[model samples]
Every structure is written in C-alpha cells, then in structure tokens.
Target: MLVWERPEPPDRPVPAPLSRERIVQAAIRLADADGLDAVSLRKVAAELDVGPMRLYGYLATKEELLDLMVDAVHAEIRPTGDGWREVLLSLAETTRRAAHRHEWLADLLGGRPQLGPNTLTGGEAVLAAMGDVDLDVVVPAVSAVAAYVIGAVRREITERRAERESGMDQRQWQVTHGPYLLRLFATGRFPALAAVVHDGPHLDADQTFRTGLDFLLDGIGARISP
Candidate 1:
C-alpha cells in the first residue's frame, strides 16, 4: 500500500520545488528500496526534503497513492505494442518482469485487477491481440494467461520475500520444515505435489509461465482448428 497526502502548492512556494512527478518517482525509489510498506507520505516528503502536510495538492489518500503507484508501474511496462499475439506476449513478459523486480507487487496487484486506465488499456491490448479469435477462445485465453501470470508472479514474489525476510534460503527452509509438508503429502492424496516437494525449485516463474501459456495456446489451437 502507498500513503499520499495533498500537496499545498501555494503554501510551499519553493524556488523550483518538487513536482508531483518527482514525488511519485521518489515514492517509487522508496518503494524499490524499502519495500511497499515503507511508502508513506511522510517518508516520501522526507525523501523529497519537504513537510508531510505540503504534499496534499497532488494526491489525497493512501489508496489513491497506491493506485497511482500501480498505474505508474503499469505505465513503465511500455504501452506501445506490436500485433495481437506479440502484444499480449510482450505484455505478459513485461508484467512478469515488473512484478519480479518488485517482489511485493503481485499481492498488491491481485488476480481481479482494478479498472485503472493503464490496467484497462493493458487488458484491451491483450484482448485486441486475439482479435481474430472468437470470444470463446479469446476470453478463456486472456483469462488463462492472466490468471497464470498473476499466480506465478504471486507465488514467486511471496516465496522470495519470505525467504529474504526470514534470512533463510530455500534449502535451509526445506531442511528444517520440508518434513512436515512431506508428511502431509505422504497420505497419497497429493502424489504429484509430493513428487515435486522433494525436487526443490525445479521450475521458477519463467518456465512455468511459458509452459502454461503454451498449454493454453495448444488447447485453444486444438479446439478452434480441429
């Protein structure tokens, strides 16, 4: 979440002071360095060398700041894209990279996305890419890819953040606690999961994204063509 306050442009008459853009950029930097929870208006003001109350002219609330930050990150993904498939693929990859860069982003950006302009435009671009396909495949295709990407990103970010936050890497984590999870899986209801539990992080997000995307495309192709 982000914390934003109004900026009083009239009260703080500075000699070339910080712009809203600058404030947001500062916020982004703060977020990148200290994680999202650190992005308070006071902290942002501190980063910009200004009073906390002086920031009120730009944004109103924490939710507004978060929305702007989300939109800002979305804007960074490059709105311009090529053809439909290329566009969607680029969007997917761009989103994945963006989320990966900010490990706390995925949970903040859940599966059911908000209708911010950037968010809507990004979705429109994806749906437009499958322009030739019928709604059936197109709808499922979009949802599947989106859902898969969100899930992949969420899992990746949370795991890495947890490991980093805990000061323990996966190997030690597995060594200490894998047995309990293993025991739970030993009941035979989760054979596939059990098989992978011992294997470690065999497939990080890149492979998983590609695999799920390919699976969906293949299925769509089969259904539509045959």
Candidate 2:
C-alpha cells in the first residue's frame, strides 16, 4: 500500500519521534543539494540522527520515499485562472518553474501517475475548471496538455543542466560549434535548416516554451467543442 494510505502511527514521547514528513523532508534536502542519487534510507536516517532500520517503520522502501518527495513537490503547483486555457497555462508554467527549482524533478515528472493528495487536488482543480465536458473529450484534452508540459519541462531542464555543466550559454555553445554546422549547411544538404538557423528568431527558453504551449492550446482548442 502507498504510504499515504497506511495509518499513521501514534505519536511517541521520545525526544524526537520519527514521522513520514520529517523523513521525506530530510530526503528532499539531500536531493535538492546533491541530486536523487545522494538520497537513501540510510542517509535520510543519518540526517535525522537515527539508525536506518528506524526508517522502515515509516517507509517500506526507497521508492516509497521518492513518491512522497515527488508529491511534496507537487504541492507547490497551484492552479489558477478564469478559464480552462488560462488554468492550463498557469498549470504548465508553474509546473515548469517547479521543475526548474527542483532540477531533479525533471527525472521523475510524468514517469508515472501520481495519486498523492496534492496531485489529486491539482487534478481536481483542473477538471473542475474544465467545466462539464464529456470524459472522452476532456480526458484526452487534459492528457495532451500534460504530455506536452512533461516533455517540454524535461527538455528545458536537460538543456539548462547541460549549459551549466559546460559553462556556456546556448549562443556561446552555438558559436563554438558553429564551424562544423556551418560547413554542413554550406554543402546545401540542409537548405531548409540553414535558412531557419540564419533567419529564425532567437527566443530565450521561456519564450520558446510559451510559444510552444500556445501552439498546443490552439491546436487542442480547434478540436474540442465550444
């Protein structure tokens, strides 16, 4: 059973009683600082100054702890806006920002359906804002937006991490690698690509994401009923 579904143990009178929240928070701190690989039951227990075995009473496995951590982050995604599109846009933007804040989130977003309270609450808000559309139509619409958000957020985070590690922004990287690409373009093998690279608008990451999301919403709007 999921940790949330399990009954909470009664509070003990010990100097520092172990709880699921404390354990998950400690693990998140570790992950936020050193990435997910740094987080383990043993390490979390040690962070709390307890033995590893003490954690098993609160969590069954490391996977359960991860689920809790992900859900905890989802709590940060608050949906707002007057209409369905606005609400979805807000959801996408906030989720993207959250993933950026917690870079490790890119590794786990959309990997599975999260049924934690916060996730379910967010979904409830979205669905409520979507009005009374049929499940057949509404489900796909929401799913499409979700898929786009997940893919875009993951790609953005990956690129951001790459830039950070390589010590070069996108323009610098392009300039540094321009020679090889320019040669390929000059060969007339990628005339269409060359034209875009030479003439296309250079949008920052935020602009790119917003434009893509607007395009997605426009496409979905055309397909769904008024």
Winner by lDDT: 2
Give the poorly placed runs of model 2, Cα more than 4 Å off: 13-15
Write down the lDDT that model 2 would get.
0.88
> How many pairs collide in each candidate, listed in order?
8, 0
Q: Please, what are the lDDT tens digits per residue for candidate 2 over residues 1-226? A: 7788997677664656888999989999999888899999999989998888888888899988899999999899989998788888989998998888888888988777898899999999999988866778778988988899999988988888898899999889988999999999989999999999999998988899999999988877776655
How would you encode candidate 1's per-residue C-alpha lDDT over 56-124 as one tens digit per residue?
777777666677778778875653466555665677788888987765568677634565667777777
**Residue pairs in steric clash, candidate 1?**
5-56, 6-55, 6-56, 6-57, 7-55, 7-56, 7-57, 84-129
Scored by CA lDDT, what does every candidate get? 0.73, 0.88
The RMSD of every model to the true structure, in order and in angstroms, is 4.6, 1.5
What candidate 1 gets wrong by more than 4 Å, as runs, is 1-16, 79-83, 111-117, 177-201, 223-226
Query: Which run of 10 residues does model 2 get worst, by summed lDDT?
Result: 7-16
How well does candidate 2 score on lDDT at residue 76? 93
